[model samples]
Target: MSRVIHVFRSPDRFIAGTVGQPGDRTFYLQAIHEKRVVSVMLEKQQVQVLADRVGAMLDEVRKRFGAPIPPPADEFTDTDPLVSPVEPEFRVGTMGLGWDAEAGSVVVELLALTEGEVDESVVLGDAEEGPDALRVFLVPERAREFVARAHSIVSAGRPTCPLCGEPLDPEGHLCIRLNGYRRGVHIDPHEAPDSDDDE
Candidate 1:
């Protein structure tokens, strides 16, 4: 079945945002152009990978085409939060990214579950066909904005234990680096423990 595609060219607003706090957060990518708005839900890893790729894409664009990159907007974070994101158009099943030669912009395509291919005998869990995709085009500066805000939101999650390089909860963590001996002990990731030299 042919999928419906919402294409936003040089979108006025394109950003990645989260709905909840830290550990329980839900990630979303929103694209807005005047009255038309398209929102989609995706995983945290997807958000992180997208940001990294977008940043790398910019560097490649510069070296390859000498594309002029606009100065990133003064504001890194969204001035206005996710708009009417309660009902996402779809939960993204797959995503495609590329540069548009004609438009001279980066295009992000988000796909949702494909309806036509569903079959009774085909085993529900595994399917060959992917989801329908929406294409969003953004200028260099706007893409940079997306990467910056995405990084900010993704990194704002739980603090990491410096010793074992693992996430630490608000209450603290039972650091695995110390092994089973420190099972009950909570290590505060943010605080620096002092050392005593005196014998």
Candidate 2:
């Protein structure tokens, strides 16, 4: 069964589509405005998966930045309302979908970000539960910002890991701490399991 998902959208503009199978990593993203059809295949096979992640990020943004407009009555069932294409305070823009049998490659096009534009290439993550061919990835601007800030923090040569209060070597640190209960691979894999067992 094909599942329809609202990938990214706001009070003014939105993007939504349906995913049918888990074969190709790509699908097609259709944008609607004033009841006109604007179709674009987001060449990447894992678009739906990426869209799911982006949707989650947007939810987080809405929670931290402020709040998302309450879902209108019958928001799910109601017909797509007339909306402007203006970028909203929300952190998502320019949605894409793709499939492999039809499209050859998964392509990502950045539309906007928290500050301005995002030009980094989207990287597909390792496959998970679903079909290997139906992978997903995204290059949200906020994520890039997180990376840039992290890099800045690392290069800034401050003291202690921002996440963990561990001291660093003169050559710099490699994130050996796990503030969010999630440690980097740099930590001893054997130690993680042993530590977890203790907990």
Candidate 3:
């Protein structure tokens, strides 16, 4: 059977959010318009990059097509499990962003990961049979809101150690900058973990 593509045109909602706890989170991109809903899985880094790129895209659009109305408050869904029951449309392999000059929308194209080689059938226009893909078109202002919310979601994750740049649990981390010494860990006289850094 031919693969399906989910498209949300001028979605009423488009946002990036996470599911699960800070250290064990799964990032998701979701859109809703009319009766359609689309959700795709992505990496945390992808969320960050998507947000950053959206900001940049808006800037370019402004310079070229005059400024759009300022976006409303950067608000994402506060409810835990951004998308409940957690079913993903597809695991995103590549996400592409572009502007529709005629329609004045930011087009987000997500390509799914194929099992093997790419579908070369997508040469001129249509695809006869292809892997899953999702597309969402957001107005400039809505795009801005999505970007802001995305940043917030990414930052709400586990804190990073200032020294070694690794995620820090509430108990602290073993910072390589501290020569493999775990910050705030008691070095008991009885059983201290042997470390080459503890010279």
Name the top TM-score candidate: 3
Error of 1 at 142 (Å): 0.6
Q: If ranked by lDDT, best first, what sequence of candidates would result?
A: 3, 1, 2
The digit string of per-residue lDDT tens for model 1 on 35-142 reads 888888899889999888888888888888888975444358465788874568888766667888788888887777554653433221223444545688888888
Better of 2 and 3 by lDDT: 3
Clashing pairs in 1: 112-131
Best of the candidates, lDDT: 3
Task: Report the lDDT tens digits of candidate 2 across residue range 1-199.
Answer: 3212222221122233333332222233344334543333343323434544444554454465554323212112323422334222222344333322222222233332235433223312222221111122223332233223323322333355566666555675666555345544587677765444544
TM-score of each: 0.76, 0.27, 0.80
Runs in model 3 deviating more than 4 A are: 67-81, 115-126, 182-199
Model 1: residue 110 alpha-carbon error in angstroms: 1.4
RMSD of each: 8.0, 19.9, 8.0
Error of 3 at 19 (Å): 1.1
In candidate 2, stretches whose alpha carbon ends up further than 4 angstroms from where it belongs are: 1-26, 43-45, 69-75, 78-199
* Comparison by lDDT, 1 against 3, better one: 3
